[model samples]
Target: MYSLNKIIESTGELVSAKVFGKEQNRIFQDNFNSIWEKQRDSKLNIAVIGEFSSGKSTLINTLIHRNLLKTGFMVTTAAPAYLFNGREDYLYICAALADRKGYFIKIWEDGGKTVVEAYKETGPGLYKTLSKDGRSWIEYNEHLQFPEKLEDILAYMTTVEDAVKKMEKIEIFLPRNSLPEKMVIIDTPGVNPGKKDSSEHEMRTRKILEDIADTVLILFPADSVYTQTFEDFLNKNAARFMKHAVLMITMMDRVQEGEREEITEFAREKIKNKFHLKDPFLLSCSAGRAGKDEYWRSKFQKAEEQLMDNLRKKRERILAERTAGLLDNLLQEMNKTVDLKMEEITQKESRLREASVPNLRRTLDESYKEREWKIRAVKKQFKKSLSDDKEAMKVQAVAKVREELAKRKKRLDITKYVQNEKGLNAAVTESSQGMIGRAEYYCDLAGKKTLELKKELDEILIKYYGTIGAEAENEVQGRHAGSDVSVINSLIGNAITDVQKQENKNANSRDKWAAGIGIGVGLIVGGPLLAVGGLFLGIVGGDSLFVESSRTKVLNSFSAALPEIADKIEALLIENVNSAVTEQSNRLAAYKDQLEKRYQSVYDQIVGNIESQKAAVMKEKSEKEEIKEEIRRLKMNLEQWKRSR
Candidate 1:
């Protein structure tokens, strides 16, 4: 199961659902479920696709001799078939992904029972290319060749040539068995054969081949120079499976020595000079019954052995790449989270230092200074006005006394005159006394106001500069606190934990991820349903181009697999993101509340101080007015004596 080359396919398939939104995921899942209908032994899935006489089944029979499929030099098995697998008294069923036409084998033991199973054929009821042969059933791609058994191959080919075809394909259904199956070899219809059925079968084969065949086993019959079919197939689509393809030249024994040597040399030259291939063996062998001339068996075994070893290397390489990618993504995400936290803290600290507590207090203090300056200026102006008014009143008092004296002098005979003058003077004197008193009161009020202003200003300065909230805030320079500092802080702590936590998470968005899984009815069952999706899977069986090289195969597998890993990873990330946001928003709200309280407290203090200063100035002015009234009477009496003179 683990050696599944399809693991590459499966991984790609599983993760793709997470990639193209839920829509793509549904499509992929739908396809997989629709197709992956069979169970098989834990056998290697060998998809044999080629021309009608490309010896695809012959190769399979060669591999599984004990269960050799009857081959008689023409097309024999018409439907896709499986190679039975057994190990340790356990039988593994070889089948296709319940969805697609390609064959694979897997093994399973349920309660110590071993059996192989394909979709139970309910009837001979046919749907387009689909057919049922006894208990196991599947649609047959006609291009898939059974031509190694000559008579059957000719019968089928003749039907294909005749064009009036009834059977979509001649299908052979193997009996059902429990999977954990061994290699299920898929034989595909030959492409571009002269017969009409050949075209029909070829098209179906091409669809599957282009779409889902993970690895292509291209068989080139030995002793024959590369044909246009081979050239065209290799040249046109070599890139698709450039990472993992197997090129096999069968029937090497047929070639004479000189021809054999030339062919061998031709193969080597074709690999290096034309195809520019390396490392991958260009094998020559025969897929016919293992007899005196069965050279291909040895080559097949060698190829199988090499492939098995290469499979491990490939798996390890894939694991390494994926693991590295996972680690890299984790590192990136961790760095981003940490950077965000630090940035938040830095901005807050900048605001705290450059725009918060200190600036707020500075603004308040500057306002206070301006207010104090304005008050002092106003008070000085008032003081000068009071002083000037006092002097004017004194001058008026002297002038009135002189005017009264002149009146008394002009009316000599003193007693009546002086008494009259005194009466007049007394009346004038009463009016003058009120004005003088007002001036003196204004002077005293201004002086007392000045004193209170100085005192209150001192108190306000002290208060603004004081207070624990302000002090506590000023101390936090965005650095860790010393002594009783919170040695373990949440934000910083989370970063450390994230760094230490190396987890391979599947998806963060549980809901969305789950949605992805349930999106398509096809993938819900998990198999290849590429037929429904119109995938060109049969291209591997295109009549002439059956032997694509190895490098192409590996690349094709990689291309199919990697994106799935990324998708699943991203899904998990998005899920986590939602949770993080929810949690962080709650905590942030609490902090905001605290900030609001601090702002309000400071705001109230500034407003209250301004109001208090204004009230004090008004009250001081009122009290000073009272002192001026008493001073007025003394000035009025002096003025009266001058007037009597």
Candidate 2:
């Protein structure tokens, strides 16, 4: 009802995903496949093994309620034989073809899937008809054989060639509802027999013991306590291969009735402790001598029931243990990854803490102040130089203007053009346009001078910060000794280098107009020229407009506005320089803070991911340990129960 088979299958899949390494994963996957194949509507293979002349065949014959196998006067069951319950009689034999190897053609419902040419007649060569359920039958012939009676089966198995057994294995199917549904009783060739093919028999027996025996039945004779050879065989195999084995002490009738209990106790104790057999069977197959008896029949039946019960319990135990074993390996593999990652994270955190410089905020403040002082000092020196240049430019502009005006006033013959008010107005407008052009040219020169001075200041700031950035890198490497702060160093270092190489095409570059310095004196003085024609028209119409007064108005505009325009231009240059200088200082000041924030963010992300993964692994490991412990306790309880019984 528990469907443990399903659980076991699913667990294998789960372990496959969790286990690491290609080979390791593949091994577990194969183990799961094997477990499923052996458990899924599959037969329990009970291999009957004993010395020659031991009552193994007789015991089996009596148990199945038919003389289904040869008992006396045979060459010790020359080949291995498998007995199963079938609706009709069937037999299969695999014979040695060449080089100590054997091959048999398997004829199944699927129409001869395998054909081995090692034998003379291969493939479905003997079968005449397949049943409605696809069960087939074959005839006795050269390469294929099907014997109907048990005597014929015995005669076929005893056939030999070149001192080696011709037959490899035999399958005898009997119609018996009393046989366990999913069970196959394999009657193997007796070990340590004095026969020519004894080595082959031993080899086959050992292979079955190692590979496929779910339950091994070790038969001994009650007439003799234990032969040295049989004891040695049990020593080598019982504890190693027979986790679900039973020690059957046959020939009990040969011993005296009074000493039966002593012999039984002696054999049971010897087997239970030495061979790890919890229960050693004591029964006699001597009833086969006078034909099978009801008493021996009942005894073998009872023993068969006990063996089936043990098989059931053994399967449950083995499944639980196998499941636990795989889960244990999976847990171990996962723990390796978990522990390694956790160690890396812990070491990183430790390194970070050890390398962390205390009073980081104070350190940042000090570094900021150092760069701030350099910035302010450069600005002060550059500011003074800029002011001096502006004053000199203003003096040159004033001197050039005054000299030009003196020469223009002296050259102008105002009397000639005075009679024609239009000519006089035109002359005055032309002279005003010339003066405005000179003022704009001077303002343009002043703008260039301001850029050159600012460029020089910026270069100084760039050099200072470059030095600061280099020093910061050295400090970071020294202080955070083991911790990786490469990202932080790169960001700050790159910021400084970028500002140094940043193209300042707007600074002192020709064809690059300074948008900050507006039209200067041109917009103000040029506006009066557009109105000069209106003034000329008014005067020519004799509308009380004096030509000389108009001349005075135009000349006064240039002379009076020159000083005011110079001051405004100087103020605009000062404002622009201050802005550039302040921005540079602020950027340098924030770099330290930005680097700290970035480092903290990366550190937090790494720690968070590591902790999350570690927690999950730890939780899973804890749960697996609990399951393992419970299974351990269950096995312990089972052993205690067996001992008590």
Models, CA RMSD each: 49.5, 20.6
For model 1, the stretches where C-alpha displacement exceeds 4 angstroms are 1-44, 66-78, 84-181, 234-238, 271-276, 293-645
Q: What tens-digit string does per-residue lDDT give for candidate 2 at 489-602? A: 333233323322321221212112221122322334455553454344333432122334433433344344444544544454445445545654554555556544544565
Prediction-by-prediction clash tally: 117, 0
lDDT of 1 by residue, 1-645 (tens): 133234334434333434233664565455443233221212344456656666766666555442334444554334444343333453333333333443332223357433322342334642232332312332243233333232233244334333113233332233334222333445665554446455466655666565534456777766454677656655664444434566677776677757876786677667555565665455566656354344545656676666545443332332323323332332343345445545655554444334234454454445445534432343344435444444453455345434544444211222232234344334233423433343333333333333443344334433533332322121111111121111212222332233222111211222233334343433444345733232232222221121222222222332233233223322332233333333333323333344345665765665565456546544543543332232233234323423442
lDDT of 1 at 580: 32
Q: Give all TM-scores, in the order shown.
A: 0.33, 0.44
Off by over 4 Å in 2: 1-3, 18-21, 89-150, 158-168, 176-178, 238-241, 277-298, 308-318, 321-645
Worst 10 residues of 1 by lDDT: 476-485
Candidate 1: TM-score?
A: 0.33
Candidate lDDT scores, in order, read 0.41, 0.52
Which prediction has the highest TM-score against the true structure?
A: 2
